[model samples]
Target: MINTSTMVAPWWQQAQLGIFVHWTPASVPGWAPPYDPAGRAHLGWTSYGEWYENSLRFPGSPVSAHHRETYGSRPYTEFGGDFADALSGWDPAEWARRFRAAGARYAVLVTKHHDGYCLWPSEVRNPHRPGWHTPRDVVGEFAEAVRAEGLRFGVYYSGGLDWTFQPRPIATAADTVAAVPRGAYPAYADAQLRELIRRYHPDILWNDIAWPAGRAAIRNLVEYYRFTVPHGVVNDRLYPYTPLWRALRLPGLRAAYNSWERRTVVSDEGFVPKKPPYYDFRTPEYSHYTGPDPFEITRGVDHSFGYNRNSGDDSFIGRDALAALLGTVRSDGGNLLLNVGPRGEDATIPPEQQRRLDWLGEAAGVGSAP
Candidate 1:
């Protein structure tokens, strides 16, 4: 097990505030049902717009019904073209300015979400979905822009559950474990992550879901990352699907695991893996950690992290609520990684989301946008 305690506290711990940007092809059809933040609903009813493709696969799910009514049999993959076209008008510098004005010390962009779409034109081709990534170097431009504003840059990659590889609707905890792509995915993810480290030298390696590789492989990758980007920090979600998790696929075990997952989701303690090989900090999504360990609270300004066309002012976190949340996190000596989901059609941050950020800036004594 790699010991993060020996390493000095990195810049992230002191940064306090970071902005997480989720801009994906899913934003083209951005819509998700109202989220029950209490974690009462199943994955099929997920409120995350970024999970648009997966939710659409569930029969009779709201996303599927919405897709049929809205797009009229258009495939989800077609959104890639629309997303590419929309990128023509995106201004990375403008986004960077907004983040800086919002009092963000760092900005983490979703280079690749679970939908298997890469924001950057990666050299490591996706065998299952060729030409699926954007032609423009979205990651590079965003990184440059953020750094130019004196803010650290980071990247978020879905190391597990690439929909193109598995194509299964994850409806349960066991399914979520089983959805980790096997065979080529482990190697492909490794290569792509290494490429990102080499090309972008991101200050943070924020992976989602779980890593497909085992402990040894993950350790090697972490070592390489530390050597390449000495100041880089890794999140806790890289926990691999080990034998214990694999056993969850068993009928009886699956039921028990799902029950536990449901309980954990709503627990006041928040969700943290039993024992991971390594992680610089814990990430509690839409939840919080009660332990003294270093943690970062990550959640969108609205219920969904990706732009949701259905979300209104009621779905957003108001200024007072935002202030309270920040105060609580700060009191616990943790950082807050607030998220922004720009529209896929024009890559513009929605006015509702911008309003919250502007409020945050004013509260931080940073002048709000005029």
Candidate 2:
């Protein structure tokens, strides 16, 4: 729980469009189920490249099937090495330039996803899984590049789910909530966030999943808002941990998280008792509703947020649609945080995603190339 008394909206609230970069080893295989078996894939369950590790854990999920067929009985840990090697060819400067050209006011890179693979050179060790972090300083390099382009830099850390920290297979929403690590996981997230704040001082601290419910988590969130980060913003997902998700009421997790059951409500963006504020801004993923809330609608042009080699030819937005999406978001008094999952091998934005971004830049009168 951050000390909300000191919290204020960062420039991002009005700056509008921010680009979310979800590049991990998952980009290596680049596949997700495309649709949520539970329901309402559009609101939340489209595609997420960061879930590669978890996908591999399931015995029958598409990701698991794909992994077995492609990699064959190999452990998922091998992809960490592969992903690190792929980092050698990454071009941060070019990425920053293109992000600027895409009219991004801020950029959030996934410093660590549920896989427990850290992008930056973190001294924090994964006690659950040894040798799980990267030796390269991806966060520092990328942050510097983005800031140099005048775009505010942000970090997305998965405090709720870490497959390496909790390696059980999960097939349902309840199973998903049950598997989140608690013991030392919160400490790990705290240390990494402190490291990110001390080193990069990211403008946004985007957390996915609720934070571990404990003293340390509260302390860290308070310290982050009070001291380490200035002008920093947090997302709605930073909630006190609820073991077994009592907050979501047993089996209503999907419904609470924006299934058709709760249409107007944004999932997991609940207020505390009678607390007035929800967040500095609201986050509605994969939809373009003309709402009145101060919000940021994040969605991938394709079905998945990460690069999906298997996303099929029709799974992307064209230049016209991209421009229209931006227009709708802006006209609705909301920000559009578009997402791009770069190929891990070359750290390149797929041509389809980039083409639309180029058009968005031109439409916003930011770039001439489109």
Candidate 3:
């Protein structure tokens, strides 16, 4: 029998602030550098990065127009080479230093987004698109840097979607769910995740869109707990649909934390009812919320999570707004997860985002060792 009394809460709970990096091949041109609006009527303008390649799939979409005008019928895979060249100069240590200065207690990096480009070279080949991965071990280097700074390290895996496995681009809301790989993808993801565990031993496992609804997922998660990290932290996003997966897994295996990311309702919702659906912590992105329970608010320094050259000074979450947000989230008993979307060509945080970090760092006792 496991003794529940002696284990202390993982460091992530105490480490209030974090940095969520959203960088991928989309950052290369950096589709308008992921997801350009199609035609005048095709959603006008949007910045959801996972929809980058999808936008390119639309012949009349702005993404395709821009690509045709610029790259001229070049396949999306072509950008991988550009991204690789850019990543060659990436400085993981510099990023860690910046995070420490920005007052981040932990850092979550996107090892793989929906586009299916693995930041780390994976032995698990994508049957649909092999050799799409970079030679760099981005996850490993970043993990080392963050841990060296005494900050918790976590990885974000898109267990639910990998566009390489699906040829059709996601256009409508229905396409989002439909694009989920149903064949050998679960097992393929399983192999990659196992490799992640074996190679990185991440302190936090942040799976997006939830895991595949199958025994493979269950098995991977079980082994994750059993071997990789017995007392490690995990977020509530383990299941794509909460209502269904909530009852599917072992009750004891529930994630250590509950996260509500990418949702915009930021005002305080009185007291959070810590009942059946217990949430260790709540995440409020780009807004502030009121509650006694722990809440982590996320702020994307720029308009887009992935690199977007089009984002001007007006679109950025500059020093003033960031300062205000930091104060607000702090006062509300929450953490602020400031996001930085690095450029694909250089894997460097844009100058605008870095300026914001410098502002935060200039303040006294901010993002300091606690």
> Which prediction has the highest TM-score against the true structure?
1
Task: Write candidate 2's Cα lDDT for 1-370 as tens digits.
Answer: 3233234564765787899999887787777766543543332233566677766665756777777888898887887888898888888999999999878888999998878888987887778777777788999999999999999998988877888777776544445556667677777877777778788888887777667665455555755654776577766666566554544434666455435334444343221111112345556766544434466787887767788877766778777777777887777777888889898777788888887778888887888332
Lowest summed lDDT across 10 adjacent residues in model 1 is found at 266-275
After superposition, the stretches of candidate 2 with alpha carbons farther than 4 Å from their true spots are 1-7, 36-46, 214-216, 244-278, 288-293, 368-370
lDDT for predicted candidate 3 compared with the true structure: 0.67
Q: 1 or 2, which is superior by lDDT?
A: 1
Model 1 earns a TM-score of 0.95
lDDT of 2 at 241: 67
In terms of TM-score, how similar is model 2 to the real structure?
0.85
Please, what is the whole-model Cα lDDT of each candidate in the order they appear? 0.87, 0.72, 0.67
User: Over the stretch 64-111, how does candidate 3's per-residue lDDT look in tens digits?
Assistant: 777788888788888888999887788888899888887778899999
**Best-first order by TM-score:** 1, 2, 3
Q: In angstroms, how far off is 308's CA in candidate 2?
A: 0.3
Q: Candidate 2, after superposition: displacement of residue 347 in Å?
A: 1.7
**Cα lDDT of model 1 by residue, 1-61, tens digit:** 4444446256777889999999999999999988765543468878889989988888788
Error of 3 at 150 (Å): 2.0
Instruction: For candidate 3, give the lDDT of residue 274.
Output: 21
Worst 10 residues of 3 by lDDT: 257-266
As a TM-score, model 3 comes out at 0.80
Q: Candidate 3 — which residues are off by over 4 angstroms?
A: 1-10, 31-45, 219-223, 240-281, 284-294, 364-370
